[model samples]
Target: MDADLLKTFLAVIRQGSFVGAAEQVGRTQSAVSQQIQRLEGLVGGPLLVRTSRAIRLTVAGERFVEYAQRLVDLADEAKRAVHGLAVQRTLRVGIVEDLAGFALAEILRRLHDEAPSLQLEIHSASTRELLPLLGFRYDVVIGMKPLASRGGVELSRLSLCWLGEWQGGPVPLALHPDGCGMRQAAIQALDAAGIDWRAAIVADGILPNIAIVRAGLAVTVLADALCPADLPRSQGLPALQPLSLRLFAHEEADRQATETLGRIISETLGAAVC
Candidate 1:
């Protein structure tokens, strides 16, 4: 039995929606749905029932939840027995919202399991903000930048695309508030191409931005990995350049814990990019 599948199931149960669970676990909603489908197949029955607004556990899921908890508890106990105990440390980690939505949960879980006493203070923001927060405010920051930019090891490079509905005339844009790398890429691409566009909905955070796009308010530039399947890529739009996610560390923090956490995050999200 895969512990990850169990955890994913529990996350869906707790979150009540795949989108919410994906954010909680740091996986795409599509990935979360696939995990649930895999778990149902393994269990030989449906575990979740999806309504228009929320997801509910089926009878099989309810029964399996208890076993899942016990299994995870036993696994944690076994790990603790082998590694002994962990020392107390407060870890301040700054992560770009894009990466956080893809693989934040598992990375944080790995760090906690590896060092039981590590208390995490997570700050999720756009790469533009997270980059500056590194060292001064955060122990480490996981951010996205143009592939051409030097500094930090590249974890993944993703192709960005315009996503949402096209209602004709002056492209309506649902953009991230000023400081986002994706926003800059979109603006630059449109300007370079001499395309006319307007910020129909200027929002902060991925969820709100996605909501605005889904409502057909405006189109936004997003990585193929993070974009939901239902949101069609807008046609006849200027091509946006690719971006690379990289890691930045502050030497002032605890080297061992920071390095370990960074390795876990990089390993978890390496495949999320194009």
Candidate 2:
């Protein structure tokens, strides 16, 4: 009857195994198993029948799951009733591709540890895509502050800086795929300085960009605090001015996921770079 027990059981059912349930709940497998055992003891019945590779819900357990899910959901609803969280379920979040490395890892880790219920649909795109989506498509998104959104949104300031590979070779440049905000910015800086640049000979998601810098392929922009320390970097011909990234954060009415996601992002990213 304990709400936490039912929550644990439900997590196990959703994930199909203790290991997955543990990861989902941010607990060890043994800890998850103990919770199930406690639930069985409380209910005076076994909830699962286990074989070598499979664990099936017992008849009573199967019947119990429906009510358990409802009960846990009701508890969540009750929490929302008095103190509601973000309302969106399938929260589509947009992140700049460059932040995916150091910035995003901290964000996701904190989110996983804190907000376990928010099923995040994270999309990486350039500022071009994320800006409009924040206004119309996604529930809550992260992006650069759009010029036109001034009246409608608020922003958190972040410092962005340009970096380059230090190798004696041609100015190696790392860029997000076409249509990315960082790519446009880097191009602008290069054009202004009249420094010829080349595409990222190696490119991929946020993490790969960091790897590229470490590998001496090219330089990419990142939050000043979050820049990788191991890379051989230079400011190049004329020093590229540091950029202050204004993270546009929107709170949506449809999804409660935002509160949790925000919590995770704040905890993880807030401390990571600095």
Cα RMSD for candidates in order: 22.9, 15.5
Q: lDDT value for candidate 2? A: 0.66
Report lDDT (CA) for all predictions: 0.83, 0.66
Every model's TM-score? 0.61, 0.49
Q: Can you tell me which runs of candidate 1 are displaced by over 4 Å?
A: 1-86, 113-117
| Per-residue accuracy of model 1 over 144-230 as CA lDDT, tens digit each | 888788897677787898998886688888888876778889999989988889988887788888888888888998887766778
Residue 218 of candidate 1: its Cα lDDT? 83
Clash number by candidate, in order:
2, 9
Stretches > 4 Å off in candidate 2: 1-90, 108-119, 131-137, 145-155, 167-170, 200-204, 235-237, 241-252, 255-274
Q: Which candidate number would show the highest lDDT if scored against the true structure?
A: 1
Decoy 1 TM-score against native: 0.61
After the best TM-score superposition of candidate 1, give how far the Cα of residue 218 lies from its true spot, in angstroms.
0.6
